[model samples]
Target: MKKVINNPENVVNEMVEGFIAAFGNDYKKVHHTNGVVIKNKPNRVAVVTGGGSGHEPLFIGMVGEGLADGAAIGNVFAAPTPNTVLEVTKELDSGQGVLYVYGNYSGDVLNFDMAAELAELEDITTKTVLVNDDVASATKEHAFDRRGIAGDIFAIKIAGAAANDNLTLEEVARITQKAANHTRSIGVALSPSSIPSTGKYTFEIADDEIELGMGIHGEPGVKRTKLQTADELTANMLDYIFDDIELQENDEVCVLVNGLGSTTLMELFIVNRKVVEILNEKGISIYDTDVNSYCTTLEMAGVSITLMKLDDELKNYYDKPAYSPYYFKKGRG
Candidate 1:
């Protein structure tokens, strides 16, 4: 319940206002909406992604050159209303078309679809690619039903690159779907996060325990057990992710060690250390790696590992440079 804010109900609005003020040079708040579109008008295919707030550097922090062209900001841990999505879609649509990429959550799917339908009334063509990368959410038999998490970063980057390269809307959508399907992730939580409004923990765990395979929004993990060492935890998570994807020796991949919220950089690097070691042992080449709190739940003590299996096409797009508030990368190595 300890949060630095004037009022719980005003957190989303206040935070967004501050964001626009700070990043005004790069983005502008859409009129009458809690969304921001990149200041640089998109001449190519426009890209948009959004979801609930609280996960900083996500839906919002990602709008800029080479990333999301527009983002609909929503309430803490809640989906953006269909109206919000519609407004963002309108702002992002260039003469070419618009592509919507977001997690495969029910609320997002429902609202984004509605927004797309509304955009058609204006003759603005729109398409969507849902990111469902949390391997722990479902078995391979039901992979499409899996929830999205940190792997969103990869999906966004890949799609943005394709769009930046001037790929057609249909081509961008196809490649974006390919990136979404090739990505996989798993997370472990050491402590639950507290919602600012209620000042209540989403869930609880013991002092010496951890929850494996948990979702960013505190969804139940596969199991809760005494905490294991960094190596053990990394192995458990990687094993599950690898089993879900066919990553062979000599294959190349991108690694993302994403902190849920409060986990330290020190801890994330420790996890990354083990991730790289294991990948090397398995003969997978690391193209490049990122470790940071890109997507997060407020004050949640956990981290998620995301691996995007790469082909030449995926690698080319992934290497394309991008600039946003939180995520910035100069093209590939």
Candidate 2:
């Protein structure tokens, strides 16, 4: 396996050290832990989310003034330990309480639950909103039980804004759940990524093949077929998502077309253009649009599209100002 690194075992630690060196002054690392909290003492409801590494600008990238107050880092594709999450919660807790938002993977659910239990011993009230926005994970009949994917960005942004607006913990949790319910995501992978330590691809895909509905961690998707043009790929994904969500004309939505690591910005934009065209033809109004490599699967080459059905309340919170390493917007601008 060809990669740029010192040692496979030390990649996570080294990368994290470099991350701190680049942005540590803007944030503070929790002592003896793989976590970071906002430099400013949190005066409002604290927000925290995390999972395995490899998906940069995810849990950590969202740590800033208007996003998560703290993030617990885990190993590549592995959930953070309960102790690590507990420490982060303790460090970020203000008198107001905290909200935990994370994907619906089993490991995360288990570890965060343990961390929440630990925090309860200290009388630090905590609540969690599981993100299950991957439409490919399940049908509408099982939407609430599906796995989470790129839609997490919207959930974090909305919840963070609520917290920044001085909403109580319960309110933030409610807002986050609402965002999750309104959001849907579907992804296609052209290539697989290698786990640093394993020195092997997490999954295998033929050179001219693509996997639809694949999970971020190389989980099996709905189907595999020969690679199609960008327009065809986008249509296939959007059709599945629209059918699942039952989006209608005159619906206002926020669109996110995200790269899964190795895809080029130009390619993502090409896909986004087609996505916008199709949505417009259907009379769906886009309230806002973001296209970037916000979430990734190591060096996998693919992209996911997320559409969040928006109402006035969701739009208000989404438009609120946010500044994180990965996302930035002026307040009410």
Candidate 3:
């Protein structure tokens, strides 16, 4: 509870109000809900994404050019209410359609599905592509059941780019699903994040310990071990990713080195160095490497590596320029 805030109950509301006030020129608050939509009128299929709060620069900050059109937000580690999602869908749907891209969490799955059904009743075409990229959460036999972690942005980026190209909702969803399937991620948590509402740490680990395959929502990972070197930790993570996706020589990919809150950029770069070296040794072509704290868990000391296996079709959308305050890319379009 060492956070700089007034009341825990008002965290979500106050944070969102502050976000709208700061980014109002390009984004607007969705009426009567903790949601925000881009002010730009839609000329393409709308892309909407959201999940529990606490993962900053994610569902909310991700709404902008080349990203989501709107995002319905929920409280810390909670799902957005069905009504909140519905309002965002209503605002962004410009007769083209709407696509929902979000992490594959049970809460998100339940709420977004309900909202999609509600949208359909009103004749607003809607589709969903659940992001299931956390390789440690499930085995290949249960791949679809894996939890979505830092890899959500890959699916969001691809979905937004396809929608920006004026692809129909169905096409955009198809491409996004492909991206979600091709992407794989694994994380090592050196520590745990705290809950704003409860003012308690989600979980705890010893000072010299790390949890492999930790979920963003603080679910205990597949296994825990004493902390290891940067190279060893990253190599261990990459092994899980490679086993899941089976990357091969000459295969291209987008690498996202995501920080889970308290992990520093310096540390991330060290991890990225090892990642690049391994990729080179394996003959995997790195299409683009983004090392940043894009997806976070509120000062949790951890990092997750995401690799999106790409083909020509996926490359086309992925190479499109994306502009958001948090995630900006100057693609060679």
Per-residue lDDT for 1-333 in model 1, tens only?
678899899998888889988988878888877888888665889999999998898988888777888898788888888889899888777778999999888988988889888899989899999999998888889988899998889988988889998989999999999999889999999998898899999998999999999998999988898999999999999999888889999999999999999999999999999999999999999998999999898889999999999999998888889988699998865
| Residue 111 displacement (Å), model 2 | 0.2
**What's the lDDT for candidate 3?**
0.91
Worst 10 residues of 3 by lDDT: 324-333
List per-prediction Cα lDDT, in the order shown.
0.90, 0.90, 0.91
Q: What is the lDDT of candidate 2?
A: 0.90
How large is the C-alpha RMSD of every model relative to the true structure? Answer: 1.0, 1.1, 0.9
**Best-first order by TM-score:** 3, 1, 2
Screening candidate 2 with a backbone cut-off below 3 angstroms (N, C-alpha, C), the clashing residue pairs are: none
For residues 1-333, could you state the per-residue lDDT of candidate 3 as single tens digits?
Answer: 489987889899999999978888998888889989999756889999999999998989788888899999999889999999999999999999899999999999999999999999999999999999999998999988999888889999999889999888889999999999899999889888888778788897998899999888888789899989999999999998888777889999999999999899999999999999999999999999999998888889999999999999999999999988888878775
Name the TM-score of candidate 2: 0.98
What is the Å distance of residue 80 in model 3 from its true position? 0.3
Instruction: Compute the lDDT of residue 332 as modeled in candidate 2.
Output: 78
TM-score of each: 0.98, 0.98, 0.98
By lDDT, the best candidate is: 3
Q: Where in model 2 is the C-alpha error above 4 Å?
A: none
